[model samples]
Target: MEATIHKFEDVLIEKNEVQKMYVNGEWIPSSSNVTRDILNPANNQAIATVTEGGAEEVDLAVEAAKNAFYKNGWKQTYARTRAEFLLKVADKLEERKEEFAMLETLNNGKIYEDSLVDVEDAINQFQYYAGLATKPHGQTYEVPDEIQAMVVREPIGVAALVAPWNFPLVMATQKMSAALAAGCTVVVKPDKQTPLTLIRLFEIIDEVGFPKGVVNLVLGSGAVVGDALINHESVDKISFTGSTEVGKRVMKSAADSIKKIGLELGGKSPNIVFADADFEAAVDYALLAIFAGAGQICSAGSRLILDRRIYDEFVDELVSRAKEINIGPGWLEETEMGPLISKDHMNNVLDYIRIGKEEGAEVLCGGHQILDGDLKEGNYLEPTIFSNTTPEMRIVQEEIFGPVLVIQVFDTEEEAIDLANGTDFGLAAAVFTNDGAKAQRVIRKLQAGITWINTFHPTFNEAPWSGYKQSGIGGDLGTYGFEEYLYKKQINTALEVKPSGFYKG
Candidate 1:
């Protein structure tokens, strides 16, 4: 398929030579002169440069966030009034959806169609949190002996949100909308590799007249800016979405001050295909399970567990369909998958494929790079499939974070459930079965934070999402996500001014 040429300059404003970070409502240069080039992984080209912030910038950003929370009307505003601002932000996002979506594709190498969904989800998140904003408060409880008591939910103050490169805008708003709804000030550090989309999004945020310092943006490498944000004393809470290894570091750093933390981390999710499942439907979903986002999704169903009865036929059909997917640049209308996020990531995925072959797993199809014609300069990996895999292989044990699917056969329902629960990461899993009773059984038995029955990768804003065990801590989305930014307090009031009977006696 011939890829379409996306002239980003036509849609987006001319690329500013250096995109300045937003701090205290001002677009300013970094404290240091350092900067990083944001690349378009589609062709390994530098698309834009952003000011790379560090400890000094984080200090300023956190201080600004703290001031906005304590010394301004943002926290004191009525819930409905806050909801109005959120609604406006959502409207603005809708108006500029295409521009942001295309920018995301150019910046992150995700298919333009999928990137549009990210923008739409971001807009919906703002709207959902806008509704929730009006409904998050304290409750009054009846008490005895002229004592009245109530529980109040208050903002946790300055929040530092660190978003990942994979789903930049959606994850940012997932945390940002919730924190803002709870009336907390925010300092956001978008991943340095793909900061353009969020930078554009923040322009709308600033235009909406969100109080100065209410929403701040910093652009920098994770080591310098991210560490400073997590360690800052003024930051009351931290919400991060990234790898599990980094999540541990964030948790340890936040533990020292007992700062509130919410983490949405990695996964090696399983997709079980039961013998009784609709054969064609399972095949289609299984393809989307791993190939969607080119398997860069945190919850990508990388482990395919097949019932022994359907194992041979299913693997054959899956390999046949995998070979037919169109691979090219994300902007192409016909392209089904895009390149890996970056050259380094592409190498990492390729290394896993090599390791799978060395470990004696059979490659059913696609185990090499596609460097032909227009794909030569890009980081395009053939959607690879490895069959005859075990639960103990490194390819099965660790997250490849690519479009490499490992196949495992199961003889019984118990074995399928056990294999799904075998991994250390329990972020997400799906069970494909025609029987409602068996679906319920598998859903209950699976150890993942999110589960799908006869479906794959479908999520809504109304539900909470998190993981079990090493998948990290806390959750995002839904009322649970909104509450993560809030701290509760109990008020005990005396209805009558009377001394204690014991003291009087």
Candidate 2:
């Protein structure tokens, strides 16, 4: 089928035409020669025929990255030159933001504006990491016992960046720019469901003049490509963003070779609402937090904890507004919430909603599929909310990764804190209140890496993105993220003039 959206014609939007994976700076077919058609989630139509790869293709990419890091000049290349390449990539992306944003919408099933925002965020990450590329990464110290002492940060070699389908470019650039900025050669793999945007981004990376073998892209299932990259002995690091279930597999496989791993995994975060909060603002942000990407975010505020005083009124208001959300094709200007990534996922989310009902949870607003007109073909579900839910319910305990929010009522700040920190995942939490002291005290007690006092989700590029518990290890974004790509070494020199050497004995 031709691309449902004509705007993508100028971009790489041909139907059923083979798009090759990037390896050693060349676009090539997978070793297996297997291919899959990538469909637009908005209408479930084929947009591009992308090659599916396996361990052989992954080995080739890893070898290329290993060669680039050790044999090529990438290891010895000056930091400023690396910074220049990152800045150039950011600039090129800036120039084609509209084109890239449209592609994101067509491929990922998010609103056009959200797609643009994600693209802009990706550009900002590249630019931010570019600045860090030239900045000082190590420090010299004065030690009383030593003539000279210092610690230097060095890039980890041969990184494998495994990204997810949600926010494909944003998540890809989060790892790619940082790895490149730290002077680590990378083999990147986008999730099989959504490879078009990253494929196009690779085109931009090639145009920006990265050295051949410095950066490579292998597109395939996480079971194959992800496993190969994780277990590859030559790869010094593995950076992945996906579900916690797969993350466990990643941690196990990386242990086989002791490769350093950075993971930004799953979350079933809580969004708390106090009665004293600016009611309208709280309502707006709650909707934005859960339904923004159709709630396919790792850090999405899936659990909504409400103060008992406003439980009835707040649920009523939330449901009233949620019913008005403009659900349609992502390419349309009026679209607010788009379809889920695929039919299987849409059904998975629906299954959770069904489970919620079976567990005796109250369905407040939406609870079914959107089967109207053209939307019937797409993977669209409603912005559902469930109340009367206990902490033991599956809807409250698991990462549904959809626009389904479970409502919990709390009478006191302590109970709110309990509900917020009740889950196994600690990726993110938010509290909305007019009481500053309460906000501070409650937010501090909430167990999460990223927290907001009065907001739901606003992840800045300058700050660290991390998780506390099963949300996975290490982090992404900011200095903490940059540090993940590097290793610190201690150096000390004994003064001969001072006769500090003891080897003569």
Candidate 3:
């Protein structure tokens, strides 16, 4: 069978409803009756409208989640049953893969192909956590004494998850699936900018028959709904993915109630190209690292650290390839890169490009907006590259969250390591080299949670995903991620019921 291509008009036509929040297995509008228009970003069109949920609605969602955990037996559900639910959800998601992918592309403004990959990753995430749900959750230890003690993992009760807009469906699944697999109930607040896909996901969840309130969706601005969700006394844990500033705020809010928190925050990841590296492969990976998602990726390697020996040639080739990239609407089959998430985002990126130029860095190539026919209204910016950037430049230090790359040259491996580790973030980094021993040595000292040698941004579900510094507090996406929604308890049984000899005289 041939692959099916989705048109933006068709996606919009299919998405006819004025979307609403999903709470306690019901489709409802916000208590305030306020709504926000959901933009396509590709063409600056309002494709849908969603409830602008606030504290009132979040309280309701949290109350429902608490009830599900304490009153509805969700927290006590068997691991196999939870796993079965997860698998069923995964199947349902796969059945609607195209629809979700189209929604993701329309809402997030990423290339359709990237949106499809996001759906695939989300499916894999659910399936992976499904398997983990039924696996061994505790350890048995041999003791010297007669008493037997077991360390068992139990659900951490209600989890409040906040997802970012970059990979809407995938990030939601990353947090929700793990929390569910661990037998915890959840209330998810997808980024208000791109809540369409997640809202649809909850429709599937409701159809698949999760106990009422086991999973809920509250759509709204973060400042409004997010405050109530994280600071709720009944919320046992908080899992968030977004900027460092917002992550810090979530941490503070969660601290008020002393809830367990896991954050996957912003990054200014480094992509280093060594002198002896495979030049063409390094360029390709560099492109993948920075421009794959139009640089909206939290782990985008926006900082390119190049060996001075091959710096000029590598940068020239990289700039050439970047210029050749076809930038347009996501639905275009031939487009390689898509627009920014919104006009504000595009302007922000253009401001960074200006700042990079003002700081004495050369605009290597493609730093202007594409304001031509049919692209005038959309949020499109060229994949930008800057050279001669210094460590102190704001564009080099800050997370632009755009399709912008800053280049800096290094003379030695020690210098490269220092440059890579210089940033406050340690979320991700990549080292390109052919020498195996050098690759290992450099990666070991790279001071990042996730590192790639001869690669860029490929991650697996079987491994943990996290950051070393302020990039995040904890991780998500593996055994470590699965355990974040669980807490350990020790059960002790006495071998003898009789009391010990002589207490008082």
Candidate 4:
């Protein structure tokens, strides 16, 4: 499809040059002098040039964060002070919401409406952490033998937060906000494919008057800067959101340092629909789960498990609805879904569709690229659905992370739960049913971390989010997420005199 070319001035600051890295509160070109082209996936065009970082830059960023954490009084700052900084960042983000939204769409290839929501959520995350910073709680305990005991939660020192390209601004905020709230300086390594929004975020951080080196942004491929950040000795913790394979590598790299690690990884989430569900509502959620962000989310409900009785009807309706979705550049108001992140990602999705066909899954609709005018130049793939998919098929078990949904029929509730739980991932799952008892049963039996009943992708800042099993370790959002950046220390004091060694009782 020929992709629509929206004018850059409408979405981004026309004069803003793409930056390579934000180290010590300043933007500088990489020491290596190598640069990477930042492409607008919406139109397969070069939007800007970003410096490519290597090990030397990573070391500088880490050292800067460590110095800020220890010598710059960032960790010793009062909670309210940190909260104020976060609120200021939020204010700055709100002021630049429009510019950020446009940059998000231009870089990530998500619809303008969805990117706006992401920008809003990013701001909300900052505000949420701002409140959390001032409200950190400590525990006091009474002890015998005239001793007083207490437990305090302190910042874990410098943190390395590696964010994914799917939701660049929101994901970065998810880690950085929580860590900063906990009084930890941070080094953020945004995905190379969509580094523009995060580069812009660094500008906001500078404007907010955060202490120098409190927050750093480094741009490079995962193999370079990402690994360096994960393996840095001075980094006390690592928080990451990405694929499971890469998450494993990060975990391994962090093992040597024994750093605290929080991972929010991949998912092959299942959306179960029972015969008694509100069919229209269920279909709406199912489509939203797969098509939102072009199914690039880690929590995308790729597996749609339906009761055999309604299987045929659900498949027909889903395919029909998906066919009606408008595909174009993200800046357009009418576009529902945009292109994938890159040509490689687009090809990957198409390859998975081919594999589904070879594996004997029936293509209900849309197994090709959208090649119409304006979309032709972009990496646009049609929303696809596959029926008669078995649990063992790659299309059913693997996380395609694309606008593709696989349909599986189940004979009973037990079978539905079984099919849903039969994957290596346990990120998120959803069920559509009117029966409260059955919903409760499925919720209990399902192995996923976050379960959605009659809803999908409606996460709030107040809830703790993470995966079970191979989906990942540690949590994000809520109090649980804040605690990930902290370490606990217990204090015991003798309140009364103790007997000397020579004294007899």
What order do candidates take by lDDT, descending? 1, 2, 4, 3
lDDT of 2 by residue, 202-239 (tens): 89988988999999999999888888888888999999
TM-score each candidate.
0.97, 0.97, 0.97, 0.96
Candidates in order have lDDT scores of 0.91, 0.90, 0.89, 0.89
Q: Which stretches in model 3 have alpha-carbon errors above 4 Å?
A: 1-7, 13-16, 500-505
lDDT of 1: 0.91
Candidate 1 residues 95-213, lDDT tens each?
A: 98888888898888889899999999999999999999997378999889888999999999999999999998999999999999999999999998989989988899888998899
Q: What CA RMSD would you report for each candidate? A: 1.6, 2.1, 1.7, 2.4
For model 2 the TM-score comes to 0.97
Question: Model 1, stretches more than 4 Å misplaced?
Answer: 1-9, 12-16, 503-505
Name model 4 segments beyond 4 Å from true.
Answer: 1-8, 13-18, 500-505
